[model samples]
Target: MPSHEGEDEAWLPPEIAVTVDLVILTLRASVFQVLLIERGEPPFQGSWALPGGFLRDAEEDIYDAALRELYEETGLEAGNLHMEQLAAYGTPGRDPRRRIVSVAYLTIAPELPEPVAGTDAASAFWTPVEQVLDHQVSLAFDHHDIVSDAVERARDKLERTPLATAFVGKSFTITDLQRVYEAVWGVSLDPRNFYRKVQGATGFIVPAGSERRTTAGRPARLYRAGTARTLHPPLTRPTPSAAPEEAR
Candidate 1:
């Protein structure tokens, strides 16, 4: 190849494709699940992967592209959802088609409605995170790594933020909140201790002036999320050795 006049041609940039992938997570039935889609097109057709797509416009911001892909692939809106940039995966050969770089996003929300698979996805559904992590189910591209990172991020966020409440309704019981932590962290917490810690956390939750009666237990006090977004004195997860003793 010939270089243009007055142009430095020592090196040339490689052609790369940029895309977005979403690891949408939620706590349902006390299990952590992630949204995955079966790719409808080639280069991994019929394989399960995180819901995402290439940037529709070169001028679009990465985050905006993520939101658009999320909605387009899964029919889930990004409004009122807790979404953040997770990590970038650009390892060569990560994508079979070409040198594709992916910017992944993580989302946490309460139980979302059944997703309608869009043009890019043959099918879409929420699958337990354990299944993906355990290799019980396969994922397309380098999505396995993306999902793993998203789960860890979610667990970390729950310890220092009011994110757990996103798993439940506006007004929830202390038990309801505790379950969210247990599901995401994959450990049981002491009921009494968890209650005390949550109540002590300044502005984490405020009493909703109501109670809900369970099947066999007495009425449980209800609470609504408060002003505070992050926890000052974080609710650290109890070690496995200490958890058993604390529960007693």
Candidate 2:
């Protein structure tokens, strides 16, 4: 691996540029959504693209650059965000202007205040992943693949990591937690088992001394995400085949 200064100077080919992209996900309408901005310039103009920008000389760190790009493209401040370096994409001929390598990051937010596009973007909005994936996306550069990778990472995180807790409010209910699971997993879980499993998980959630009665039927206790960032003994996912092979 090249040093930071070397990567910026000698390693970067003139035809290849470096940029940072962010995949910001949040829960809206009880479904998971990703933020996309409409590109205004050429090279996939008028197409939806991830919020990103080229690195500047003043930017010292790649992670810091990504956070800055996130705020620049979408006027939302990086609040208690669960952000991590997702991956780097460098496929030859990915960008028309030049060969571009993009460092991607995944951001999970509770509830976004609002998004205002600036610079290379025309407008920004929170879009359902299904709606965006359903269409043929010829995005700017290799963004389509980058976004796909980010989405898959988020899905896998939801499986074993306590990432879904980021979607819930400071204080939440079993139903609220259930909704996060449902939205991320895209599967309906048995309410009884879901409740039992969640309750059994040590430090997965803690009570905040609050209660709310959902219109559904019963009054539910409210809780908050525990200090634990991860589930020690990760929750086991239900496998499709639980029975032994049939006897011949």
Top-TM-score structure, candidate number: 1
Scanning candidate 1 in windows of ten residues, the lowest lDDT window is 2-11
Error of 2 at 36 (Å): 0.9
Best by lDDT: 1
Q: Number of backbone collisions per candidate, in order?
A: 0, 0
Q: How close to the true structure is residue 102 of candidate 1, measured as C-alpha lDDT?
A: 96
> What is candidate 1's lDDT per residue for 1-248, written digit by digit as tens?
86666576556678999998999998778788999889899989999999888888789999989888877765667776778899999999999899999999998888777888978789999999989989999998989999999998888888899988887888999888998888888788888888889988899999999999888878999999999989878998767787677666
Task: Quote the RMSD, in angstroms, for model 1.
Answer: 3.1
List of clashing residue pairs for candidate 2 = none
Model 2 stretches with alpha carbons more than 4 Å out: 1-16, 136-138, 237-248
Provide the global lDDT of candidate 2 against the true structure: 0.77
